[model samples]
Target: MSVESKKTREACCSKLKLFLASMALVFFAKAFGGAYMKSSITQIERRFDIPSSLIGVIDGSFEMGNLLVIAFVSYFGAKLHRPRLIAIGCVIMATGSYLIALPHFLQGPYKYETSVSHSISVNSSESALPCHSNHSLSEDETPDVETRTACEKAAGSSLWIYVFLGNMLRGIGETPIMPLGVSYLDDFSREENTPFYLACIHTVGILGPMFGFMLGSYLAKIYVDIGSVDLDGVTINYKDSRWVGAWWLGFIVTGTIIMLSSIPFWFLPKSLPKQGEEESQSKSTELATVAEQGNFLPEENQDHEEKEKPVTFQELAKDFVPSLRRLFKNTIFTLMILTYLVSVNGFIGMITFKPKFLEQVYGQSASKAIFLIGILNLPAVALGIITGGFVLKRFKLGVIGAARVAFAASVGSLCLLSIQVFISCDNAEVAGLTVSYQGDTQVSYNQQTLLSQCNMGCSCSMKHWDPVCAYNGMTYASPCLAGCQTSTGTGREMVFHNCTCVGEMKSPAMNMSAVLGQCPRKTDCDRIFKIYMALSVTGSFISACGGTPGYIVMLRSIQPDLKALALGMQTLIVRTLGGIPPPIYFGALIDRTCLKWGTKQCGGRGACRLYDANAFRMTFMGLITGLYLLSNMLWGNLYLKIVKRQKKLALRNQAKENGLEGESRANGHASINIDTNKDDTDKESTI
Candidate 1:
């Protein structure tokens, strides 16, 4: 290989290393964040008893900060030396971590706290104890009750507000780092290696959440220990568990330290992007040139013009209008944006809701439900990046194809899941333990037990009693009597022995376990995790295989430079537009169709309780199947369109360009003939 080629390879390798390192930092930070977030919620909830909805809003607010600041990070951060930008971001992120780590000592003013506390006490008294005139009650009546109400409303509210502030501040620190780090590598790497660098960064970045969760979980255990302490014991010093001493806050402080230490490393020379002078000059040339016309005026006037005031809004608007018009007129760009928004919105919403849908279907907890989501998402992301990078190496795939394939897959999976859900919902079988009382004894019924009992005897109550009868190896005096009778003197005499007493038995409301016994040493989480793993693997495969192939088709049809832009547009459009369906459509269905068994406890709320096995199973199955199926259909249509567009564009562009070349050739031939005739005429005149 040429020395130049060798150098290029070396440089690419270095960029990849740096990119991976940065990504690792990002991943660790996120890992910390994830774990911290989970622990924070638990801590804040316990400390202040805040509602989960408020927490969600607060959590989402942090994400908003990231969204709003990302463009700034890309624009301004990109302008700065890559290392410097990264360092600055690191510093800011560390500061935010510190802010989050610090507990809010001054919770409103003391008087405000007291007033809120007083108001809550008063409210409690007003609700629980009626106000009566002195004369209304007897002289020896119970003294005006002075009950200690537990509602420390101000403390609770203040605690969450503080957490929100911490998170928000932390977000400010974090937002710039991502684009800074990623773009740094992009700038540093050659075109071919850019994607690999990006992937390295991404993969390494994933480690952040993993690390964060591990760290957070470990530290969270400390918090849990503190919480487990009995405040009832006078021997223990409860005062130490104050704002500064709180394990949650303390852990944040430790995390902040680690985050801060990484800041200086961002200044390392290795992190900087290598922009040649030519590239710099080219970029500078693109900016509008300002020339001061030979001012016949004094030096002062010339100086004033030299330091011309920043462009006015009006002037900027005038310049912008033409560009806007030009861009708006482009059908391709417009379509690209629309496609982006649709794809992004749809995919994001789908991922976000997948866990909830799973939780609903499989009768799993929120955390457990997310296993599938996590598995699916990482692969999806990986595939998207990998496919996008690899597909357009030679040919160019526009946004259309990427959008089509991504959406189609998303739609297909969603539809399949949705169908599964619908079938589950419509099916007759309950997910959890199906128990029925026959005469007296409660009998456990499942597909297996039911079949066994049915096969043993058509109307044998003894078969019903066999399962629970051996609960403790003690036989009950009264067992359920089947439709069996003994012959008596006058007629058939029905036996009523051991058949009058019905005892209530408790059953776990887990369908997976009930249907298929304890997952052989695997916790509910483990079993759910397996399913999540499968889903994730499937999603990853779909993304890698489907996304890459689709992009190849797209690039072959479109120009290379436009591919990235097109992809971005597709993501933006899909994400924005796709978010509406679940809340509007699925939510409506859930509201309209109440799936309750009519028991007072279950029926009070139109929808069954979260723990209700039958209710959960029905809901989840319905949701997953419906959504997956819809996704599948949508994806298929989008992919097909993309494929067609790719083929057409390629053919059209080739034909047009080829036709122009042929015309030029013919024109040249005609000109040559005329020149030859002129030469001949000149020779004849000379003779």
Candidate 2:
């Protein structure tokens, strides 16, 4: 090889490596941000005093942002400088990340609502008051204007909007990465090498969520009001539902990393030469000789023609309608989109709520749940994606084979998810909520149920959710509900005494007292949680095994020219329809399962204090299982169609070859004589 040729080849190789690294970096950064948001959903909810349904709306804002710009970017962006556009997107994502954390700074220090106030005077006065029938304060007394205003200011009125808008901006920023990056890589890399590159990108991308959730887990253990409030004065532990973490800190860290990732893209060229283009050009003469010996290469010729033709803006505009029409005409592509839509809907819902689910159902702390998902589930998914790519490459699976692999993985995941219904621990024993104070199993779920004979004279406000654990191991809505007349100690150590609710317990001593926070579950619950996590990790791995193969099936089925547009449309449709609605509805359903609801300082209902675990499990898992089953049926139909179409194409190509051979044989002798005469005439003319 010539020195110049070797130099060019080396330069091309270096550019390809740089591009791959850049793509992976951006992928990792974005994945980290998105996963961090998912992991912090519970914290965000508590911090803002919002219900699950409202939190869903907040979570879905990212998709709303994607819906605004994805179609235009995907279509017009292919004709523009893709690298620069991606860089700009990264900047926007960073800005959005910073914006999400802005509320944490703008708002006052986190102050959780508690029955026990921090004021020393108020504590002394409350302790001095003896047990009396008329001691209970009336719930009807409205707060004065000054107090209401202060409460609203303390609650950070509508500050969550910043988070929603910021998340939406993040969504818009992420719109360009996947469709453009994948198409760019596919265009520049060799066909056989594409899967490996994608697998690597995704494997790195999976690490983002792992790290993001890990960060979330760590931050969740720290108090949200860490520097602003006295940790000693705080009564709640990390396990309490009211605990809010330093959720904003991760956003700052992730945002900075994402901004750094954008720098290299700005310096990179708009496009690079196809992999091995130099080698192909060097072998042109030999390739032409092979072609003359009856080697057919229409696909290669078409590719060459496409590269030769420059795309104009007008031409792109004119071609849009025709291209869209052609894409939807393919039954397999449409079915793939539908199946993916359903699967994504389930996935979005599951990921958004899985941490909350684990915390409620299995009696695990929020931080621990997030940590387990990050450490165990995400790594398993990464392994599955890599293994799936290996399976495709090793077996050289075609479109139909890839579909089968995806379908099987979905079935396996669905089966495992179904088992979760039976794996849950029992509902928490909350007094006047999930169970009667008398330890009766009969549970009532009405507002009136909160007012029982034991504490009716105490005039306990139904609005407050200051839960206190009783000696009977049952938790009351508040100390007042337990008919506790006096308290001892201070902060979390303070204990209510002379509780009438303790009479319901069959113990001989009949000691009457209740402390702050919800009661912990039995030791058996921990064993159940371990079992659930093991099954969850296994299911995650199996489900992720289909990721690469399913993506390949879509990529292979689509035309090369429409690849970016198809991917963008798939994202647009899936994100707009699938991503935006699942959280809202799933949260709405989960809201119904909330046994105890917290009261906001501004005289409105706040976040849920406790959930009916059995109901939450059934609702969450049932929806996921149903969606997966539907996706599987669609895959089965799609597989049969692909097989039938392949057979037809094979038959048609064979018939065309036979016809061409017959025509050549018929003209063989006459063509040779004519060629000889023409050669003799040409020689005479030259002389």
Leading candidate by lDDT: 2
**lDDT tens per residue, model 1, 1-687:** 577655655665555565567556654565456434543443343344333334345554455445545444544343345566555555666565566544444342111100011122231223211111221213113223232122233332345565666666555556555545544444444544554455445554544433443443344333233454332221111111111114355446545644754654554553322322112111221011111111111111122233334555566446444433433333334443444344434343344334334444453333333333344455455555565555544344344544555565554455334333323221112212233322223334332333222113322221111111212111221111111111111101111111111121233122111100111111353565455556545654554434443433332322221222233233223322443243234333333332221111101111122223345445534554444454455555545554554455455346556775356446652111112113232221110
Model 1 stretches with alpha carbons more than 4 Å out: 1-20, 31-52, 70-87, 97-150, 170-174, 177-188, 212-228, 231-412, 419-533, 540-687
lDDT of 1 at 584: 38
Q: Give the TM-score of candidate 2.
A: 0.90
- Residue-level lDDT of model 2, residues 200-300, one tens digit each, is 99999999999999999999999997788877677778888889999999899999989999988898766665676664243222112111221111122
Quick one: RMSD of model 2?
8.2
**What residue pairs are clashing in model 2?**
none
Per-candidate TM equals 0.53, 0.90
Please give the lDDT score at residue 8 for candidate 2. Answer: 77
